[model samples]
Target: MFKTTVTPRFGDIDGLKHANNIAIAIWFEQARNPVFRLFTPDLDLSYENWKLIMARTEYDYVGEMFYGHDVEIISYISRIGNSSFVVTQEAWQNGTKGAIGRSTIVHYDFLNKKSEPIPDDIRKKLEEHLQNEDNSCK
Candidate 1:
């Protein structure tokens, strides 16, 4: 699994004084940079070079994340398919899991405007980060 830390900004706090749900989503996306690199080594954003597209995303809030605390984000491949894969991530704060999320990303040919199978080499790289059943925030 890949791990990263995000320092919650003061602006991220909501009226309730805890990090807003939207902030968690943005954090999760930012933590995905490593996985994105597997497909686009240079991290290019040009449509002609970008090969991945987000198909769906969902998040479940399990605990409150307060500002002024660092949030640990754990990310790993949960499922791999021919043309798409699922990235599973967790947000932890103060030793408690704050949220769980899954994002479905598809490999595509922008010129063709159709989904394409992930390259074998890229698939193998993703497998290396596959989350084991026992993996979890401690």
Candidate 2:
């Protein structure tokens, strides 16, 4: 699991005095980067030879979170396929669950127009971080 501490900013709050939905999505991206980097560091960081695009994202707000609240973002790889993977996360504040988030990222071959399998080297790196001791997914 990867965990990050983020300080909610005033701008993150909306009229409801809670963190805006869009901002929370951005936070999810920030917290998930390490997992991606573990597979490929020094990536083009663009729509190039390697990068995962956000195919889908979902967030559930269970409790209110506002400015002045230090939030914890936790991420784990739930599944890995040949060309894509799923990451699950949750945001917590003051020991209470604030939100749950999940994202499916697809490895794309920008030069082509379809999904591309993850490279062997990168796959090895990811297997090292799998939550299961058996690494059966590999």
lDDT of each: 0.93, 0.78
Q: Candidate 2 — which residues are off by over 4 angstroms?
A: 131-138
CA displacement after TM-score superposition, residue 138 of candidate 2 (Å): 27
What is the C-alpha lDDT profile of model 2 across 1-138, one tens digit per residue?
788888988889999899898878888888988887765576556666456777998888878888897999978777789988778788888887788787888877777778889788777766665564223221
lDDT digits (tens) for residues 4-119 of candidate 1: 99999988899999889889999999999999999999999998999999999999999999988899999999999999999999999889999999999999899889999999
Instruction: State how far residue 113 of model 1 sits from its true place (Å).
Output: 0.5
Name the TM-score of candidate 2: 0.84
Q: Where's the lowest-lDDT run of ten residues in candidate 1?
A: 129-138
Q: Rate residue 27 of model 1 by lDDT.
A: 97
